[model samples]
Target chain A: MDIHEYQAKELFTEAGIPVPPGEVATTADEAEDIARRLGGRVVVKAQVHAGGRGKAGGVKLADSPEAAREYASAILGMEIKELIVKKVLVTPVEDIVSEAYVGVLIDRANQAPLFMVSPEGGVDIEQVAETNPDAIRKQSVDPRYGLLPHQAYALADFLYDDPKLVRQATKIVGQLYDAFTKNSCSLAEINPLIVTPQGEVKAIDAKVSIDENAFYRLPRVEAYRDLDAEPESESRAREAELSYVKLDGNVGCCVNGAGLAMATMDLVKYYGGEPANFLDIGGSSNPDKVVAALQIITADPSVKAILFNIFGGITRCDDVANGIVEATRRIDIKTPIVIRLTGTNEAEALEILGEAGFSAHTSMDEVVQKAVQIAAQA
Target chain B: MSVFIDQSTRVVVQGITGRDGSFHTHQMVAYGTQVVAGVTPGKGGQTFEAGNGARIPVFNTVEAAVRETGANASAIYVPPPFAASAIMEAADAGVALIVGITEGVPVQDMMTASALVQDKGVRLLGPNCPGLISPGKSKVGIIPGEITIPGPVGVVSRSGTLTYEAVNQLTQAGIGQTTCVGIGGDPIIGTDFIDCLEAFAADGETEAVVIIGEIGGTDEQDAARWVKDNLNVPVVGFIAGQTAPPGRTMGHAGAIISGSEGTADEKIRTFKESGIAVAERPVDIRDLVKEGLGL
Candidate 1:
């Protein structure tokens, strides 16, 4: 649910927060055009869902439109954190007098939305909190009442000395809080809220992560999800209603629950084999979901063996057995599958698998070890 | 003897007409739980036939169900979209314990619902949890009744099947449990490991405890600290996702390794430092539980 910096800035702008005028461009020509329109030194930042883009050479300061185009061309296809840059955000560089940090995120410990503000900025806030703990001032906003004017000003006062700067920062903090709550964001931040030489405060960099569960309520925020930025298998798994994470190992794991799925993956590693992916078919087992899960797992050429570990609480073992059987019939699965099915009609599920010429075990350890051995040999 | 529920727990089911609600309701009834009432918005006044051919009355709202049936406990199987409201409704009805089995509830909604539940002084378990089971006495939510037996150990976990795996192993090893509770896998859950731990610490039936945790949040660390400061019962702990990669959610929304925190290695270290036996594998939980109990 991570949105591009430009998209976050768009939200910031919509919420009345001052942001450096920026345009997203997919091509170098568009970048040049945007720079020309801005009529100043522009910053070309790669619009990828990752941090440390500047350190990875995905961001550059361009002195002219031609320089902007050059930077765009260089960064367009560059890979940062395994994600290829498909677009660049072109924004006019601001004349900054000082930099500060402001952000709001769901504090898991407090079970509330916490606003963190610091005079120090342009670096990881976590590092700042660790190194100079006194620099960061935090306030938890009750979701019901939201960030009151006083609370916002207190946070602003911590980051600024000038009355005018504090007023502007307070307004910006309110706007950021509005944007966060309106979009159902898990995290929203304006890293390096820059103070101009003229004393105007504005957000220079934006980061907003929408809570995935809120997608049902926030259609606009859900639409901001860039499918191209995610791996194909992940999106496909999402569409199939499967919880999947592609991994680097050779053994593909399909389990019923998230906890058990992780346990299964850990067991795969425990037996001296790596898991190629983490796939959860979830509580309700349908043949089509299993087929989709298998297809997604086998889509990874690195997968040498597949494992199914179903504990079957709400999920029926017979349904999973039917899925494995139906999936093998519909798709040509080249990798060996080791299944451990137990609970909820397990005897019937074993019969179904046995008749389909597939052997199933009841023990998790034996099946995981067998799958690991098979994957290792392959 | 159980920490939460026993045979006396009068249960009302929210979303009773729904698929998951009906299925688990039948399971709970079959497990000998006193499923007194059911709540379905438009389907109120209908009768849900339990496994024993007993007709359970369905009401339109939790308040009505609570009033009519004198139900003090509620198990929720509502969809994610309505789960928060359902929890609030149950809490508003003055239900002492509300168990939510719905997964994928928006974190913001849960935050509000949690606040309301707290204001009402009600205990809310899992908006995405498997609920709790007092073995051979009362079964709530979706934990299979057959796997557990009434005994001395108290089980608390943030997982569903992983809890079952530990319970299954314990049953195989002739170690039975007093009550097994799933605190859920969400980052912002109502009840936590510490809440269940304190309850178990006070319950005379629970001689020892087994905790199943995953790589997410500092709940485990906090729970370990609580166990150290309080509680005399020996505790065994196991954390899943030992091999899980960072920043990727293993399965549950809350089961992600954020930054350097919420890792299995860190949790295991904290558990050892707190004098809780750490099980390397799920299969090893039984042996650790036995050791914790001095069996």
Candidate 2:
């Protein structure tokens, strides 16, 4: 649900937030043409869906259109954090006097939208929040009332020097809030929102995370979901309507719920094993979900063992066991499986699992240890 | 005595005409839930029943069902895209509690829905979970019909099967649950450890509460703080993100909490500091729950 910097800037512009005029180009020629069109010194930034592009040599300052093309050509297929630079954002570089950070998210405790503004910009705000909580000012805006002008002015006062700067900052905060609520964004951030030497504030970077549930309202954000960024296992799981997240480890975990998968992974680690993935087969323990989960887990070469931990409630334990048995029959599963089956028809599930050269465990530690040991040996 | 849904609770199923809707509805009804009405947009005026011919009338909207049947709680099985809208509709209709079982809903939708629902004093359970079930009474969700043999442990988990895994181990250890809630996996889910813990703490049937949380968010820490200050009920905590490599997200969309403070170590330490029994292993959860209960 994250979009590139250019796309975020486009969204910011649509919301009437001031941003330096910029153009995206995929090739050196396009970069030169765009730079020439802008008719001034430009900043060429590598377009990737990752932070630290500036630190990673993905950004360059060009005094001439030819230099912009050179920088663009060099960055055009370069890899930054595993994401290839598909495009470069060419913008008229601005002279900045100061920088700040602004973002908005839902505050669950207060059950209201919270806006965060910090004087420290272009760095990890989390570190600042942890180390110097006071540097970041947060205000929870009531949903019905929205973010008021005074609330915006208070945040602006923390960042701006001149009163005129406060007026511009207030407009930017208001626009950011509009973008956040209207686009169904879980996070909309403008880092290094630079105050020009001339005293006008402009957002130079945009990082947005759209809420997946609100895709119905914004097709543009939904279209930015890159399948390539997701693990193959997760993509397959999505197709099957199961939930899966790949981890960097050896034990393949198949549990019925998100919490259990987490507990399963945690236990696997506690027992000196690393979980290869987080797979939730959901409520219907249909043999198909089990089969699908097995397929996804086995497809990963790094997976050393498989763990089936089901606390069957609406999903019968026997059904999950049967599905595992069925999935084993359908695929060549060389990885050893350590299963812990509990709840609804567990006796029947144990009986079925026992026949398949495996006995269910009542102990999560025992199963995790076994799985981790087996995976280590493998 | 049970938290949320009990024997006398009247339940309604939203999107009951669909395949998943019909199947889980029948299962809950068979498990002894007082399922009084089913809602489907265009499939009203029909009747669906459990195997025993316990017929329930169908309505097209949540308001209609609420008016006709006086159902206070709703179990929603609508697809992901419509899930948020469905939850809002149920909340608007004045359902005291709503359990959303759909997955892959966008976070913004849930944020808006969560804001709207909370504003109306409606509590929502999950957007990608098996929902909540109070064993041997009127069950309201997708938890397996027969796995629960009611006891005193109140279970809350962010992962679906892990709750089952925890419940199963508890049950195998001859422990039964007062109520088990699967809070779902998505990052922007409706409920979290704090919400479920509050419910468990208030329930008279719950002698101890077993909380299952993952690594991604401050939910575990928030719950730990609440436990430290709140009721006398013994609370056991298990966090899932312990072994997960730092920076890897979970299956539940809400499973990842932004920032470095969201690590499993932080949550575990917080829970431990709050005087809650912290279990690093899933199998150990049952014992922790028992120890919390003074069993």
Candidate 3:
């Protein structure tokens, strides 16, 4: 779950990390008021869950309160990476002598939280790691023991030369670590940890991604999820307990497992047809979930063909067949559905579909090809 | 001949009173697995009839079940919130192999649980996996028993139904398996491709190995490198999610493509470079496996 910059900075401040004073505004008038309160000079950054906002013209420096309003008006409704900017964060401008990068993320390879600190800041860290590998120093911190003071200082020392600056950066690193673990974040970044001319180090920008699995434990962090930023179909799917990701294609896929769902989508492409979405109805074959999945898929006007490739293990094929039959009665589905049902009472499921005046395939390849052909014709 | 569980493996079912636990427990028992005991915390001292008039004793704790039944292996069907503790408990009870069937266990919990299992020298299979089947010998988790037959090929995958798809096709082609293992689809899992590969290499019955990987971390790449350096058995590989978009998780939490890493294209390239036959589609796995076995 990605949080906006303002929310991440709020967390940073709560963790005792120094951040430029900021306020989130949903309107241009609110942005001007915030800028005025912050002594007129501010940076208006579009609060959207995407990277390269600056390059996309979603960020600007406002020399006066009126300029802040102008930047806010330009950025508020702008779309960056398909996400609409509903709000802008107005922060007081900082006098920076140097900028550096500091972040902590779950290193999947090491199976631990890894702290990556670099002297270079405000650019893609992956590019830096590829171009100048030595500039980035990484350390894996044991979660049980937490990030130790020495580990934080070592990362700070890699980013700074002045003793006073190192001390401040070390404290900030510790605070960032605290924020990371406390929030159950998969990623916590404070890019451009700026050093002022007067030698004070502070975080100028913040980003955090919370682990969805940890939401059960972290209620506060879970509450930070902005539903308005997400697509309506995605939210509806989540509520229905279905795993669905919308894509740009014509064939809509509904499968039982994650890997099989993806394979089904790939098969759709293999047959010269694009998949409209990735939808996994999960292990259980609750008829309502299937109905909800179908409704979600058909809601997209681009979905010309719907495909159900179910290899029932824990899921019962009969239940899914019943769902397809029941859904046709409850909802008016205009798109054609191609189903490949096998395993776990498959014979019974095929009989159910047959009685409902529907034909079903027993092979994945055949069903996918049939669906693709139908979608192409449609 | 099995890499992990065999005919001699005595199993204990965790969360036996729960919905998924009881259902799969019945399936495991029906498949002729020696389901020695069950653990349901509060439902100890009770008996769960497997609808075949077979009464299995249920214990309150894994330690109690292990002590009473001498259960050597355990299959977990506990929920995500308690799955980590369940794995740790199984390890603490000295279970040799633990297969966790619970999905959605927090990554941090699995990390800690994995560390504990390693310390105890116990082999943990998955926290969200479909578990392993030793063909006609022993069935552990939710993999249907009828789809597999005891034969020469060994299979390892990070998926559930996709593994079944491969197994089904292999069975249809008259190619049976020694063991089919699902290492789970999470970012962190107990058993990895390399672990299963080494085990398959040691098993005399497993003449060849089939590895099913998806887009995610560099586990496949690392496993490819391991196969090159360590094993002598022929390996056939297939990576799912060729059409998966970047940054979007394709159903599986660990199936997201992140920053120039863990793509199906890259994994296929690595497999080819490492001398493993890469299948373009799931239907092609059987033919590749047959080629690997020289059949």
Maximum-DockQ candidate: 1
Give residue A93's error in model 3 in angstroms: 0.6
Listed in order, the DockQ scores are 0.82, 0.54, 0.77
Query: Compared with the true structure, what per-residue lDDT tens digits does model 1 show for residues B193-260?
Result: 99999999999888999999999899999999999999798899999999888888777889988879
List the candidate numbers ranked by lDDT, top first. 1, 3, 2
Candidate 2 segments whose C-alpha is farther than 4 A from its true place: A130-133, A227-242, A284-295, A316-366, B127-129, B184-205, B245-248, B292-295
- Candidate 3, true inter-chain contacts retained: 0.70
lDDT of 2 by residue, B1-295 (tens): 6787888788889988888899888888888888999999898899887668898999999999999999999999988889989999999999898999888776656767887887799889888877878888867878775557789888888776666667777877889988888887776677777777787777777888888887776777888999999958888877876655554456666666565657888888998899988776666787877777777
lDDT of 1 by residue, A1-378 (tens): 789999999899999999988899999999999999999589999999999999999999999999999999999999999999999999998888999999999889889999999999999999999999999999998877889999999999999999999999999999999999888888999999999998899999999988899898888878888988988999999999999998899999999999999999998999899998888898878899999999999999999999999997778899999999999999999999999999889999999999999999999999999999999899
**Alpha-carbon shift of residue B12 in model 3 (angstroms):** 1.7
Q: How big is the positional error of residue B76 in model 2, measured in Å on the Cα after superposition?
A: 2.2
Chain B TM-score in each of the candidates: 0.99, 0.95, 0.98
Question: How many clashes in each candidate?
Answer: 0, 34, 0
Tell me which of candidates 2 and 3 scores higher on DockQ. Answer: 3
How well does candidate 2 score on lDDT at residue B116?
88
Please tell me which model should have the higher DockQ, number 1 or number 3.
Answer: 1
RMSD of every prediction? 1.1, 3.2, 1.2
What is candidate 1's fraction of native contacts? 0.80
The TM-scores, one per candidate, come to: 0.99, 0.89, 0.98
TM-score of 3: 0.98
Interface RMSD of each: 0.9, 2.7, 1.1
